[model samples]
Target: MAEKSGKAFDFRLFKRLISYTQPYRFTFYFVAFAAIMLSIFGVLRPYLLQQVIDKTIIPKDGGLLVYFISLMVGVLFLEVISQFLFIYFANWLGQQVILDLRIKLFRHMLGFKKQYYDKSAVGRLVTRAVSDIETIASIFSQGLFMIISDLLKMLVILGYMFYQSWQLTLLVLVILPLIVYATRVFQKKMKAAFEEVRTQVSNLNSFVQERITGMKIVQLFTREETEYTNFKEINEKHKKGWIKTVWYNSIFFPIAEMSSSVTIGLIVWFGGLKAAQGDVITLGVVVAFIELSQMLFRPLRQIADKFNTLQMGMVAANRVFAVLDTEAIIENKGAINLEKVRGDIDFDDVRFSYLEGEEVLKGISLSVKAGETVAIVGATGAGKSTIINLLSRFYEIDSGTISIDKTDIKTVSLPSLRSHIAVVLQDVFLFADTILNNITLNNPEITEEQVQAAAKEIGIHDFIMSLPEGYHYNVKERGVMLSSGQRQLISFLRAYVTNPGILVLDEATSSIDSHSEQLIQDATDKITKGRTSIVIAHRLATIKNADKIIVMDQGTIVEQGNHNELLKISDGYYRNLYEVQFAEV
Candidate 1:
């Protein structure tokens, strides 16, 4: 029942799906056998009725009648047992396959670089992981085995009917072509509708996710009505997609029913005429053919319904498999290891751009000695933040060598390289969990007491203690409950507790309260005293105590020195920056 061409099934997709069933091969094969048995049993009920009416009931054979009824009851029990086996194992297989597929998909996504995420929607990926895979489960539970079983049942029923009486079989068969034609058209049309429905659902999910995350901005700008209108458009498209499927169903199913009703009437009329004329057709045969015709036609309709489920499942498989097929991740080709870093860093002729030929970091070279504090001061888009991104290997550089100690960063494992460095950014993201878990991030080596000690050392212990639940406080989604200043303190504490060899503070105090700024400055002084620290700052006052100050302009380093040394030059970029900021005072 997997999606097919206009003429035949898509065996390639069928093979691919079957390949996944290899792990549970024994169970899959057993379920398939049970489905065959179920099909065989499906035709038995009509066959037994035909034999009973002809051989036992009409002949008045009481002994044979009791034996046949007992046998019929036994067949019913066998059919029931086969159905249970088919349903239970098929569903079990689907659930197991989805569990494995979801885990693989989530793990594959974790390895993808920042560029992949920049161009993709979170909700789209989530749909593939959750909803799309659920659709695939229908392949087993509704589509694959059930379609085969129904087809087999129809074949057996037709064989019995033709053997009993060909004239009546031919009468029923005349309307079969119409049902088949309608079904083919219905399958194709519904597939297109299902595709549109999936696309609209993904769009709706992505739209709602972004809007909910940024609801504060929408409310601040009084744009609720504008967003609502946009949401209505997306929702309407989704509704129209489903309506098209319903429209197709309304047209196709009634035609099928009419064809079935016509087939039954033809059998009754033709068999009646033939019986009156000669002994060619009997009452038992006429009666059995009627029941058999329902068996044949009802399955055709049921199969069309199941084919819709199969089509949707194939669409979902294509979407999920598309994500798995993407090769957009950084490969680990390096074996360099680091137990403890010496913190010597270098960027030699580093050139990088998020997009090709749109250079954000232009041939910039700089170095930080062991235990040195280098503060970078620049305007927005001056590549100050880009430097941090490259150092962390969040994005691959266009052309450059970023080295730590004597080893190039590209020659070292990502975990080893990043484990030694800690970064605190302006925008802090906190999980909707306890404060202690946020700080530790579930790192086993960093104990609760160690985090508490680090907080106290930075003079934030008293502030954290003032919270309603202290270290156990739940920060809510994205730390919405805490002020920006409080979140910044938590970030600082998180970085400090890591005891990293190198520390980075990027615009860390740019958007915080005065009290928080003072506390952060005091904390920054204590943390950067002996570590290799790189600070990207907008405020020139923050870098005055830095051992080295690198001034950037338009992706290039224009000046480099201590605060006093750079200020001595009258027209230097750092001096000019200092003048503009302090000129207000």
Candidate 2:
């Protein structure tokens, strides 16, 4: 399990969760009414039994006995109907609330900056959305409702007991303090057990997800025995948590049962003596007292059980709230619209570091004209990709000014700024969707003809058309159904469909075959003709034709000029890179 930060659970999350039920207010109200009615019926049952013994059975009245028996049957029928209605409404409400919260959380996660994903694992997020939400739903639909109804019934039972005979009621009430103390102690133990269980469950989930995702790596390394042993260790930890919870629960139930038994046994002894001593109390009254004694503890037992469930729910809620409380690093508040951009971009003394004192881009200053192709070439970890990320505003600079057409990017809305730029990454990600939908990405306003045009322009249309389903071919998850080159071609087409003012190709053709690479280069040249372009390339041949080539080494520009100008330099980075590529060719 991930280490908890020890932050208090955000109460505001509860308020937000309750707000989801606003749409189903009428249904929830009806469910609550049913639960109340059911509790009232539960309390009335013992009184009816008392009356049956006193009025009908003792007096030997057959008609009255028949009527009382019929009444009991009617009450049972009503109870069943009410139970069904309550269950239906509560389950519906719980499902709706879960759906609503998951949607909101997912949308919020989507808007979060890349940094959040860089630090958080996918397995943890999935657990929050799925298992945690279900746990909270169980709390609301069953645990919370049962607790409220049982408490109400207990109060009514106590009031009636006191009304019947204060002496007997006083003796019973003496055990109340003990019950309360035991409950408090049990609650603390249960909560600790639940927290451990929740942690173990999360760890188990993480292990399963990791094993599935890295199955190939595991198999290739021949670590099946080691992996199985690791899994067993984690599984045992989860089992231990469950075992601790069960142990506490097992001890609690017997103690509660024993306490109730002792109380009832004493009540019978005292009541029996009073009846035999010729007191006003009759046999029927004593029988009713015994029934009421059992009734009183039944709800108390339910309350105990509910408390255990509530503890589990609260632990799950804490985890869910952790995810919901994480404020996105990037947010857009104002409406700063850019109608038509000339694509002039400038980076003024940009300095950035992922962590403090570890600069990635060191006071880098550069500019690109409205329609120039600028290629940035560098070795691994030399900040080539960081420049593109800064321009795209994926990460905010620690101290710098990035502007588009003389307007500071920070002043404009993030979505508005990014909407005008399109990026083609080296590791292309295509959704498990139809080819046309993957290309257009469900942009309803984008026409089929436009999609076809983009695919053709990227030189992937012929390949797509030759498929069994043509444009409608389904690309499996992560484009696993397609070859690496095919997936890259589709990604290129996707960017081309956007036709943004600025294009960023970050080693876009690095993973493709030579034939596909040539085709993509042609398509890239055509697309970048009149747009501001930033090309980060390892293969020098791809960027040799750029209007400007900036060579970087160790977060600073080593040289900057056109291809031939850099090649003429005595011992420049660009010249050295070009020599290596040509020598290999």
Candidate 3:
């Protein structure tokens, strides 16, 4: 999908982001006040030098000179104290805002439906949550403070310089338009460059994440050389991006320096002529003008540099807001709480497609009575898993109604509806936590005895107990620390622990060995004794005892009956699948 685009920075997004900082407005205001005072104090230092030259030293008044020098020291001390407090509070406020924003972003992302993850990249999400947030924090903590201080200091110095001598100030002001024009040109170029840099960085991050996640496959295929070349290309692109950024910065600084130099030279020549003529211009005033000239250009140069940084920050902000603004189409709108469901499932003419106009489930209707065990068997891509997904409301049907206990799933609150269903898919995912935790994942309140009972019922308790840490053994990512069969058993235990009214086993035994499959089947029979169960599998033997067998083909039901009835109809899809499995055996 093409990403949402607009101006480089969205004002509404910024407004929302700033709202988070409302709690720290007091601190920000105090910091700004301190910064203004410090700038005032800083401008006064050069004026004090001018005073010592004009009113004390030039007049041979050593006592007055000492007093002014002591006063300068006192002003310097005050500036230092103010700066310390400003930095302390600004840093504190920035960190707090970042912390709150990170947490809020995380919660929002978590609340998004699975389809959102299906469309978004993990690296891009991580970049927004971590890198982009840090960039914004820097802008808030350092950039905002510096901009205020520099602009205020420049304004004060310019006002005083013009007040003292309008002619010299006007000479400097003549180049103001040129400076602004140049800054705009540079800003535009830098913004474009930074946008490209941000894109390249995101690509590099995605590449690293992909390679790391598939490292085992890469090594197994002995494609290290090819992967290395790919990485080198991405790295080279990143290097070129940074080089372009540096090149722009390098050129901008020289232009600013040249502008400042020319302004100072003009003042020296013009101001000196006026002083020589005794044209109401003292040596003290001329010296102060020179100091003020430096002060003015210093901030102008700083502003140019900061503008570059701000442009980079704007690029990051654009990416961050893109994520924040994504609207979840499927969300609970009203309080339609489902309680004590009896697990009667109905799919009334359900039709769905991941992409528009390409239906994957077409006009399919099925009703599973309360506590009934239904097995759906189909060829690959025959909509068996899609039916399971629809029943769980993972994806909304394009056309039709799905309900549990007569209430349309859409009308029910998602959390409450999903809380009563337990699903175990072919590919089990286990966190890097203890074995006990993985088994009791759905029920953190489950006791140790309950965990042990569930494991024993699944016939995996002996194997678990053999480990050094027993139930406490850590399951690595995807349960790599355990065998495939052991992982499948743990998944079964997890589902059983939930005590769900509706159980879904989507190829649950497909990953296990025949012996483990038998154990899981035995446990499944026990678990489904009182709960409604929907088993989607390719193995016909596994569902021989199902109360009903549904055979589907190309998103539609082709045949459905009891095991004996399907066998009697030799042309039925279920009988053919049974023959194929028997032939393999």
Candidate 4:
């Protein structure tokens, strides 16, 4: 699912992620300064400890001991303060970076053409916009900032160790190569493991999201046992991926700890022998070296773990940048900004295909004059919906042009073009919000009074008032609390409130009961009056009074006439289709 990229660390991605901190550069610099202060204060503690042991305890000088102890305590207090500032500011900086990143990524996704979403999983995108971004924050909080602090602390400890006695420092270096090699190997393996873990997490999220959304289908088919088994398989894979990283940590940490112990043992053995020989090495010096050795090895060990953190953040960054790098966005290059549209539409030799070499809309042509209602009747897969999609520029046409009021729609700004159109589909979606908010979509320009007026004009004001809270009623997620027909009515109100120049009803009455259909039909009549309307007719009876009924076969129009004229052709496709529907009724 997730592929490992070049190197355990990606400098390009790291640099790009760092650029987000430009807005908070002062905080970033402050954290770096804190890291330096922490290192300097850390070195001061052991030196003070050596002074207390040699200059006070050895000579029984209590006053000198008090002075050194106070200094040591002071350094410890400052070190704590530095540590606090480093943690608080680093986390603050990280939260700010991911906040901007998530917003930019979401805005980018919003501009992507429908074609891009046609092949994308909602769950995978959710992971990118939410959880994956959370992981990238660790790059600042635990990855880069901590690594720099630990490395600086280690270097400072190393310099002081050499200053005390270069020979012992050389001895400490003996076990270092082994630790470094182990850390290097651990980093490589952990990077791959973390990438796989992220991939599995995305897969698990996608599977769960889809299954939950379609739980009705799973139960309807009595497939709970089968689906549970599938879930278990996916979950088992996720667990195994994480356990592999755990296995690496299990092996690596203990080895580094044992290495640290061995170095400590070597220090005590060498320093003890030198003391017995009356060399410069003394009791205070040996004890201080012991403290310094632990200080050095601890960070070296932690650096390995923090490097994995860095690696994981890099992996997540790569995934997020991949989404940001996509060229699937609909470019708003059109200079035209039409404030109002007369709604005269034309499709001149329009050809389109959802997939290459498999055209869904053949080179077809159609027109609808301003304030006219035209009905397109076709069987499923006959490209009736494709025509609507193209008209709205949901998918680009491969050849030819679609025009609104004789102006090419491609030359009109997207917001200006789409603002003039409203669509009501068979499967209507409503947000988990109050009915008024859902209808108005939280547009401040359209107030509660306007929504009430639109509802009354569409003949659904009484229906809404009959509800427990009227327009204030909350329609839960996707309007599940409401019936299919009720949701469709809400969608109608949503569309009508916008006062669009063009109205589209794409099989809007296909699955509703007779009573709801009557309500929708009444609403439809009111909304479409004097508006250029396109109706994709599922029931042939619904379009009997349509101004123009264009019958489609495959992807091309087979008949174009009013009901009486089409019925006059006894052997025509429309006549036969109408007769079949009449028989079914």
Candidate 5:
């Protein structure tokens, strides 16, 4: 979920956002310059109006009137151009910053350890990377730049008003405290409401993404009505979150409008009294004061709303910064050498746990020589998969070292280590792409011809050719267009194309029918040739031909030997499991 910090105007967060603009520093500074120019133009316009009424129109100076009016029109043209630059450049800077931020955020996520994603939801991460960053863009679009321009306008208006008549200025100052108090209250309440709104949005996204991904389970169990009911509950929370922000907006804007009107009334009543008494305050002076007051306080009223945008951006920045700040990769702080591996793997007394005090692998020591096919067999939760996970360094071991070719795995760079190994999981994930693209995965080095050659070597090239578009076939999202067996064969060719030194097939045949399983088995045998392979499977027949078999019970290996050697001990866990799967063998 998106976490919110308490500070509404976090300078630390503001600085972090500003730092991203370094690449486009000139554009950012130019936008600021535009804002300043807008203030200058805005403040001068009202003063020119006062001049027109008192100097040109009053003394019947028809000849001078045209010149002064022309000057005012020229000023108006420049103001329009300045406004155009402000709006256009401000939004341009915002778009550019978000483009870089989204790219940086994604690159950061790619380096994180698997553990970070294991406990995270796709929807929450998507919300942060997508929508929250959009909200952050408002920091420039409707927030930081506009706020600076408006505040400057307010300052200039007040400066000229004080110079005109100090008495009316004093009267205006009397109601200033009340408006300030109301704005402060509005901002505080709005900050909390906005934070809640962001949180509910993340929750709603998480729920919908997960439910949709696993819609198979929901439909299989006939839970559509029930799931929809649950979704309505989450949706209600999301609606209420927005309603709270709207409720605060409803209460505050009208108060600001009312205060602006009251200030105008006070200015008119007081200036009229002064004119009747024959003071130096003229009609032009009173009208100019009124105009100046509106300029001063109109921005004052809009400042609270813009500040709401600022607070939301800061809150989103805090969330985004938290992800960037996490040092969760368990980084490879050792050598970064891409050495040619012989695939002689050794696990020496390795122990690990996904959570505290719940060890998954308990001091398991095992070794596999180069080019040997090893199989690990275990019941559910027997820590069979953990061995491969630790070997791959997906999860760091708590107490031992896993080494390949006599070098500690942790000492090697992750890309250098993972590049030499290929994993084919039970659920083969294929992208929404053509068969050739999925096989090559857009790697220029692995060409279409190379993929065709590898598929032929693995004996599934004929299967691909049998399809309507032979190699150019579009396997829709998650390879739903292909059968389970076809996807497994594609996974085989994918791994084989890389020519990895080590191959890991985790339950690759678990979900296949007997026919597809046989095809996968043949493909697996061809691909694993001359490579160090570790196979985890429930089918006892698949590992019967392996050089060695490791049987795990809980978190430790209970038996290790060939099929006949293990079957000789009828009382062992291996024999018990083998007998149930291959009773006819």
Candidate 6:
């Protein structure tokens, strides 16, 4: 149910939230001072009005009336100034804190291992970084200081009211307990409603993000009506969650308003009776008490609302902190810093699993000497690409070791290690940027001339220049402006410009047409010269000339040798695989 109970206040969460404001302590202190000043000014005007009624207007002392009126206006002016400072600085402090927090969250996410992201939704993380942090900012701007100021003002008003007429003040206290009970109930209900609202918001964001990213598939499969129905269901849930909050507000505010109205009536009745009965209560006392009652009740009413804001902000903080608290970051405990690598690779009895008890790569061992071109081929689910994944340390092996140049990769700093390796995947990803930026990825060290030279060598320079803007052409998101082959060609240029020691092509030629396959094949042959390369290809013919071929089945190596030697094994795994392709062609 959307009405599930939750804590209206969490002390530890609040303390952690306050720590983010440590850098802006001066602004924090200034805001505190402004709150105090606003509270003092709030009560002073009502008290001054009492004086104006009693000492000047009542006795018709015109000279004294002018003086009191001037005093009241001056107090009002200071009150406005103090109110401005409090509001301005509080919001300023909130924005600054959220800015720092958003940056910190994003930086932490960048360090997380791929495993962390495997089961996480990009949209939920986006909500945590963007909207959730924005809610947290309200804690400073409208929740804490505003609540404090209201409380202080109410206390001062109560003190002054008791001093003037203990009898009338005692009568006003009669309505207090009922209002307090109502406020407590309202606050609890609202907290739960707000929590439900936040949850639905995250779900809505996730659904929209996933749908948009997969819009191509949705259109291709003609699932528009089905997906639209799904979106409406989600949107309806979000609307219902928000309506729960509205329902609670509708019930609570009117109750608060009625209590305030009833209290004012009580004061008027009791104070008027006392004055008529020859008591100390006078007209000025009655009038001032009326104003004081409002000062007292309005804030009490607002306190409930502001407390809800505080609770909602705290809920958001808890969500944001949950992501910040994730310990899924890759362990980079290596002390060795390899500036350059020899590209000699070894995997000794390496074992791994994405899920427990479901091993994907089992007791696999392989070696590639420096400057050697090795190809791995297998049917789907045969752990072909898993080898490249493990080699790149994108996923840690459950057992055994992976080494590069005779040094354990675990003993090398991640940046220093990855710098010497380049990977080109079957599905190439290009940012929404110009071709030059996509190729160089904005690396200042690689010049335009260098990219042009590498493209010419790979035989894609003319193709790139034939585009509308040539190298400066925008590829749009995910390279939608280019064909599958063109994006792959750009990926090759991207990898080659790095001057990497090792190259990994994971089915890079799988989906392209024959023409593009030829171009990529030629590019691959050229770049593989004098460099250690690992090629995983669906087309056995493409890797026929590779120095060595490792054929895998069910996560284990079934056959491995040079292409000619593998062909000689009748009915062998590689032989059958090669024969099927040859017959298909």
Q: State which candidate has the highest lDDT.
A: 6
Model 6 residue runs over 4 Å out of place are 1-5
Kindly list the per-residue Cα lDDT of model 6 for residues 283-365, writing each as its tens digit. 77888888888888889889988898888898888898998888887788999988777789999999999899999988999
Candidate 2 local lDDT, residue 322: 74
Candidate 2, 1-585: lDDT as tens digits: 222433223345455556778999998788788878887887677777877987998899989999989998999899889888888888788888878878877887888778788888778788888898788887667776777778877887788888888878877777767777776677778778888998888888888898987888999999899999999999999999999989987887787888788878877888778878877665666777777777777778777778777667667777876777787567566366787778999989999998789998899999999999999998999999988887777887899899999888888888788889999999988888988998889998788899998777767789999997988999878788899888888888888898899999999989999988988998998999999999988998888789999989989988999999999999877888888889998
- TM-scores of the models, in the given order? 0.96, 0.94, 0.94, 0.98, 0.97, 0.97
List model 3 lDDT by residue over 116-229, tens digit each. Answer: 888887887888898887877766667667778889998999888878889988988876676777776777777778888888888888889989888999999998999999
TM-score for predicted model 5 compared with the true structure: 0.97
lDDT of each: 0.90, 0.83, 0.83, 0.90, 0.87, 0.90
Clashes of each: 0, 0, 0, 0, 0, 0
Backbone clash pairs for candidate 3 read none
Each prediction's RMSD to truth = 2.3, 2.6, 2.3, 1.4, 1.7, 2.1
Off by over 4 Å in 1: 1-10, 277-280
Residue 551, candidate 6: alpha-carbon lDDT:
94
- TM-score computed on alpha carbons, candidate 1: 0.96
What's the C-alpha lDDT at position 33 in model 3? 94
Report the Cα lDDT for residue 508, model 2. Answer: 93
Overall local distance difference test of candidate 6: 0.90
Task: Tell me how candidate 4 scores on lDDT.
Answer: 0.90
Can you tell me which runs of candidate 3 are displaced by over 4 Å?
1-13, 276-279, 442-444
